[model samples]
Target: MKNIKASMLAISLAFLFIACSGKVQTNKIPNETKYYLPKGVKTSDKVALDSKELQSYSLALEKFFKRNVKADEEKKQDIYQTGIERGYFQ
Candidate 1:
């Protein structure tokens, strides 16, 4: 009885760990050709932008795409603050 209970417990933990480690992939748009990069003052994609241009583009992408214009989490990129990076929003 003791051995059976221990084996079941181990199996449960293994299953739990596997479920938690799995990453959930949501439907995401990788590329958008409909909207091209809007013209704006060229700034460091490294530094975040607080200017009107950045705000305009960011809001437009978010409002239409329903995705926050942020950097690639896995790539360690910043908004640069272009808000639009890696064609993530492109």
Candidate 2:
């Protein structure tokens, strides 16, 4: 009976260790276009726009892209830091 209880305790502890382990899973595909504008913005795409609208759209798109890139970089950095903290790296 004591041997059976020890075996069960060891199994439970093994499962607890596995459950508590932190593993980071990421799905980041390089060279994949993740953002799109509803209306076409490229010159060769043949989307027409007036001077004022075009200027406004350009500014907005610039800000949007900058914000997204900054956020992505920050998230990547955070993941890297987490990996380091979890002893995945030296």
Over the stretch 1-90, how does candidate 1's per-residue lDDT look in tens digits? 999999999999999999999998798766776765669856565866679989899899887887444644555656754567445565
Question: How would you encode candidate 2's per-residue C-alpha lDDT over 1-90 as one tens digit per residue?
Answer: 999999999999999999889666686556556675567575465767799998999999999777867678766757778999899998
Backbone clash pairs for candidate 1 read 47-80, 47-81, 48-80, 48-81, 79-82
The local lDDT score (0 to 100) that residue 39 gets in candidate 2 is: 75
What is the clash count for each candidate, in the order shown? 5, 0
TM-score of each: 0.31, 0.29
> On a 0 to 100 scale, what is the lDDT of residue 76 in model 2?
74
Model 1: per-residue Cα lDDT at residue 84 = 70
Report how far off residue 46 is in candidate 2 (Å): 24
Runs in model 2 lying further than 4 Å from the true structure = 29-90
User: What shift in Å separates residue 67 of candidate 1 from its native position after superposition?
Assistant: 42
Whole-model lDDT, candidate 1? 0.77
